[model samples]
Target: MFFHLNLLSVFRGVLYSDNSQGQDGVDIYGPIDGGTAFSGIQCKNRKLNLIDGSPNRISNIDVQSEIEKAKKFKPALKKLIIATSLPKDKAIEEFVRLQSMEHVKVGLFTIQICFWEFFERKIPEFETVYNWYVKNEGFHRIKQLSVTFKDGSVEMTYHPKFQKTVDRYIIPPTNNTAPDINPYTSSLANLLQSDINKMMQPGYNSIFRSTLLLSNTIDWEQLCWLELLVSNIGQAVVEDYKIELSLEGFFEKAEPERGNVLFNPDFHNDIKGYRNSNSHLYIEPRKKILVQGDSFVTGSFYIQPAIAVEAEIKLNWKLLSRDFTDSGTLIVKIVPQYHVIINRHEVLDSTDVREEISYSLIKRKGTYNIGSIDYHDKESDYPVS
Candidate 1:
C-alpha cells in the first residue's frame, strides 16, 4: 500500500517517487519543487490491537509516539499527517486535539489523523490508479521518457517484439510437380530451388528475376526503421506534456530468410529498438518527432491480398492518455515487392508460355503465365504489369 500510494502521488503530479524509504520515519515526501501545500504523509495500515489491560479499542499513547518519531525527520515538515487504515474514536480524536496544542510538548506539526474513510470520500480514484500501476509496470516502472523531433520519423528498426514470440515457418512443397506449397515438405520442395538460384545470378534467373517481384506472397516479417509519426494539428493548443507509446497484440517473429538489421545505420548502437522496448515521445506544440530506438520492428499484420500483384499499405495509430484513448487506421493500395525463383523452368516454359520469349519479358515483366505480357519499354512496363 505504501509503494502504490507513492506511485499514485507521482502520477497525480503531487510528487515524483524518488525519495528515501520509510525506515527514516517518512514514507511520502513532497517534491523538491515544493509546489503543493501538503508536505509529508506517514501511511500506516495498523489495525486495532486488543491488549489484556487496555479498555480502549485504540491506543493514543502509541499514536503519539509514532507522531514523535515523525518530527525527527530532517528538513522540518510543514504539515505532518498520520494516515491510517484504522478509524479513530472520540477518545483518540480528543487526545489528538489536545496533543496538537502541545507543540513544544510533542514535536509533531499540524497533525491530521486521516482514516481509511478519508480516501473513500476524497481522491477516490487514487486507489484505482495505484492498483493499475502495480499490475502493469509493478515495483520497478519505466521512467517517463521524452521524445523530440521536428519530423516524426522513426529512424531505425532492428527486431520485432510483442506480448508473445512465435516463429514464422515456410511449408515446403510435397511433390516436385506440385504448383502449390506443401506444409509437410521442405519449403524448397526439393533440391531444385537451391540449384535454380545457383544456376544463374539473381536478376538473370528464369524465376521472378527481379528481387522486387520474386516472392509469391507480399509479406513482411519485419519493417525496419518504420515508426508512426504523430502531429497535434489543432486549433491554437499549447500544452507542455508527453505521451507513452505501447503496442498490444502486435508481434512478429524474426525469420533467418527474412533477416533483420544486424546493425542500425540510422542511430547509435545504444539506441532503442521498436520491439520489447518502451515507445515514448515528447511532442512540443505542433512539432513532430521520429520515435526511433532499439526494438523489433513493430505493428505486424500479415494481410492476404486479393490480387496476386497488388500494392498493400497499412497504417495504424493511437492517441493515448491517462483517461481515454483514441485511435485511427488507414490502408492504402500499394505495389507489393518480393523475390521469387521458379525451380521448374521447363514446366513454366511449356505450360505458361507456348512460344519462346526474350529476357525482357521475363526480366522486365516478371514470369508471365497468362497472355504474353509484352512491355513497350523495359523501364516503363517493367514491374507495373
Candidate 2:
C-alpha cells in the first residue's frame, strides 16, 4: 500500500529522535495505526578534505545516489539541509551543480559551510565568495561586515537590496549599540580650535594683535625675519620673563636693542650692564689723558664697564687707524705731579681721586696692564704742593 506523509512532520520527527534517546528498538517499518507512513530515510554528513589526499571534485555518481536516496523520502522531505566543513568555493560549486539537475529547486537546498575552514589561507577567496553571497543569496547575505586592525577599524552595512537576504543568516543584533564615529569635518574644526588656543597665549596674542593692527605698515620680509628670530631667541622671554610670547614678540625684543649697532655680530647683549661699545667711539687727542697701552694693535677693541673708570680720560676710543702706526709708541703717558688748592687755608688734596680708564686700540693684544706707557718724561717738572 502506498502511503504519503508530511515532509515537515517526518523531518521534525527525525531531528527530535536524533536529539533524544529512543525508548524502543522495534522496527516499525510501516506507518502506525491511523498515522501516515513515510519512506524511511538516511541523512549522512559529508566531509570534504581539500588539503590532504582526497577527491578534489564531487562526482556525478555520488550526486545521483544522494538524489535517489532523497527521492525515496521525497514524500516526507520538504527541504534538504547539507552541512559540510568543505572550502567555501567547493561547497558553492557543488551546490550550484546540484541545483542545475532536474527536479532540484534552488530553495530546497540549504547549504552551510564553516567560515574558519573554508577561508583558511585564502582571504581573497573568502572575500569573493562573501561578495557573491551578498549579491546573489536568496535569503542569506551579509548584514554587517566589521573589519578591525591595529591602525583603525571600520564597519559597513550592506545595501538595501541585500538586507532581507542578510537578515536571514546574520547573527542577531546585540543589545550593545554601535560606536559613534567622529565626523570628518569635526577633525578640521578641532584643528582650528587648537590654532585659536595658540593665538590666545599672552605673547602670541600680543603678536597677533600687533600684526592685525599694523599689517599694512609692517614689511612682510621683516616680519618673517622677526618671526624666525622670535621663535629661536624668544624662548628666553618664557624662561626669564615668566611671559609666554610668540615668535614675533621674541624677535621684537631680541633684535639687537634698536638704534644700537652690532660691530661684533657674535656679541651677547643679554647680560646686565653689558654695553656694545663698538658704536661709542670718537677720535680725540690727549687732553691730560693716560692711555693704558697693549703690545700689539689691530682693528677695534672693547673695554668692559668695571675697568672704564680707572683710566683718567673719557673711556671711549677706537683705533680706526688700520695700520699699527702707534704700536710701541706712547699713546699717552701719566705725568707724576700733585696739585694743591687752599680752601680757607686748609690744603685740599686731589690725590684721593679714584680713576677708571679704558681704551680700544688694535686687536693684536688680548689684554693690557693699567700702567703700561710708551713714554715717560721725568725731566720736565710741573708745579707741586
Candidate 3:
C-alpha cells in the first residue's frame, strides 16, 4: 500500500513507523512542503458484519480517542487522516467537520476520515500496484539448483580395485629337477610382481568417493567429493533452511573391502551428512540466511554409487525454509571405471608336475576363469602314472 500511496502523492517524504510501543497511533507520517508541521495517517482494518453486509463503524468517540493519541506524536501533526476499509458515513463526516472546526479554533490539528471509496476509485489508474495486491499477478519465486563437477561434466568416473590373482610354479629341490627349471614361469612371476607394486598406490584405495554408495556401515567422513550450488531468484529472503538429497537408480552391493575405504581425511571439518535408514541424506544449510538474487555453494562432499554398468542416475532434492518449500531432480551420468588388480597367488597343488593342478580365483568379479592347466611336461624324464 505504500507504493499505492506514493503514486497518489498523498504525502511527501513519507516514512513508515515501527508500530511498536508508544507509536502515538500513527502508522505513517511525513512532512508537508518542507515545513516543520507534518501530516500522519492511522490505518484501521475492520471486518464486515456477515448478516448486515456492513463493516463495523468507527464511532465519534473512537475518532476523539485517536485524535488525542496523534497529538502526542512528535513534530506536531497539522492534520491527521484516519484511513479505514469501512464505507463512508454522513454522521461520521459531519462529526469530523465539526470537530476539525472546533480544534482549529482552539489551535489543534484538523481531522479527516478517508473511507474505502477513496482508494477504490483510484486503484484502476495504477496497474502495477493493483495487479500486485488485488489481481495477484507478477509475484512469484524462482528456484534453481546446479551440480558442479571437477571436470565440468555430469559424468563421474571411479576406478575401484579388483581382486588380483597370480600364478607361480616352484621346482622341488631334487637331483633330477635341478637343470629343468622353466624360464616362462620365472618371467611370469616378475610380471605379476610389477603389477602388485602399482596396486599399492593411492588411487587404488579410493573407496570413499561417494556417500551414496551402498554399505552396511560407512564412516561419513570417508565419502568422495561432490559439490552443489543453490540459488534463490525471488524478492523475499529464505531463512532457517534444510535440504534433503537422495540418489535414485539401480545399485549393486559393494564388496566389503571397497566399502570400508576412506576418501578425504579433512572431511571431518565440514558439515557431516546424516543418512537415514532409507538412504536419504539430510544436509544443513551452510548459510542460514539466503537473500534475494543470492547463491551459495556447498562444500565438497562424497557421493558413492555401487554400479557396474553405465547408467543414468537422478539426484532428487528438496529444500525447506521458513514459509517456503521447493523440490527438484538432476540427472547425472555414472560411468564405472574397472582396473585389474592382482591381489594374491594361491598354490593349487603341492605335488610334482606329474600330478594334475586345478584352481579358481577367489572373491573376484567380472573375470573369465583361467580354468585348469596341465603342468606335466610331455618330454620330461618323469613318467606320468
Candidate 4:
C-alpha cells in the first residue's frame, strides 16, 4: 500500500575482531579476509514524457511480462518502487490493465507506482484510476504520490485513519519549563547586529545606498504608482463599475501626496515603538453618535450598507430564512459628495441608484442607521390584521 524509493549506493567495509591468546581456549578471531559489500538502489534523474513516442500500442502480453518480471524481482527486493516517465493517459492505462488481473489483486502485490509530469505536460489521467482504487481498496492503504519537475515537486501524502486514531490517544512528555518571554526582542537584536556589521563594512553602505537609491528613484516610484493605480482601478471597475470613476480620480490626485502623508513625522510617531512597549497610542478620538429609526427601516439600512461594502447587492427577500414575495418598491441611492474630476472636467453630480421591488420589509418597527444615512420610508403601509 505504501512505497518509498531511495537512491542506490554500494559501500564496502571490513568486519574486524580483537585477536588475543586466551589461557582456556584457542586464539580469538581476527579481521576477516573478505569484506562485505552492500548495494542500495536509488532512483535519480527522473523525467516525464507526456507525448507517446512510439506508434505501437502496449499489448496485454507486455503488461503480463512486466508483472512477471516484478514477481521474479520480488524475492530479492526488500522494497519495490516503480516509476514511469510516461504521460498520464499511458500511465493510467497501464495501471488499470496491470491491476485488472486476479493474481495482481492478491495481497502479495505491494509495489507502488510513482508518476511525474514536468512542465508543459498534460494533466494526469489518474482520476478514474484513483476513483476505482478508492472504491475497491479504500484510501487507508494508498501512500505516496508525487508530481514533480526539475525545479519543483508536489507530493500527496495520505494519512492512515487507523494511525491517526492511535496517535490521538498517545500521550507525549510535557516540559514544565517556562518558554522564552522576549523571543521577538532577541530576534530583533540579532538582526540589528547583522545590519550593523553590514553597515560598518567598507563599500557595503555605498552599494546598499546605491541599490536603495535605484529602488526609491522617482521613475521607479512613478511606475509603481501607475501599476497600483491601473490594478486598483481595473479591480474596482470589475467589482463595482459605479465606483470606478471615483477611484480613478482619487488615485490621480492622491498618489503624489501619498509619500508626504505616509512618511510624515507625526505618522511615524503614532505607530513607532507601540509593538515593543506595552502602551496604547490613541491617534484619534472615537466619537459615539446616536441614530433612531423603526425596525423595518433600520434593518434595510443596516443590511444594504453591509452588503454594499463587500460589493454585493442582495436582490432576494427572505422571511425566516425562506424566500417570500412582498409587493413594494425600495430605492437605495449612493451619492458621493466630493468633487470627482473625469476627463479634465469636475463632475459634482453623480448618484448610484439601486432599486429593489419586494414585499418583505413591511409592518416592522425599529430604528436603522448605518454610519451616516438614516433609511426610512413614508410609503410603508402596515398590514391591517
Candidate number of the best TM-score? 3
Model 2 spans > 4 angstroms off: 1-13, 16-57, 90-101, 104-385
- Judge candidate 3 at residue 29 and give its lDDT: 81
RMSD of candidate 1 to the truth, in angstroms, is 17.8
Give one digit per residue, the lDDT tens place, for model 4 in 1-385. 1111111100111111112421111111111224232211222122221122122233345444444544443123322333343333466555644564444466444333334333113222345444443454232232221112112222211111110000111122257754333211123244445655766677675765344323310110111111110111111111111100111111112111121354454432111112332211111112111111101111001111211111212112111101111111122222111111111122333332222222111121123333222212132221111
lDDT of 2: 0.26
RMSD of each: 17.8, 41.9, 17.9, 32.4
Cα lDDT tens digits, model 3, 25-83, are 68778777577778888776654332222336888998888888998988788988887
Order candidates by lDDT, high to low.
3, 1, 2, 4
**Local distance difference test, candidate 3:** 0.54
CA lDDT of each candidate? 0.40, 0.26, 0.54, 0.24
Error of 2 at 225 (Å): 74
Report the C-alpha lDDT of model 1 over 199-231, residue by residue, as the tens digit. 567456553344424433212222323323344
Candidate 1, residue 193: Cα displacement in angstroms equals: 99
Relative to the true structure, candidate 2 reaches a TM of 0.17
Indicate the residue-level lDDT of 262 in model 2. 46
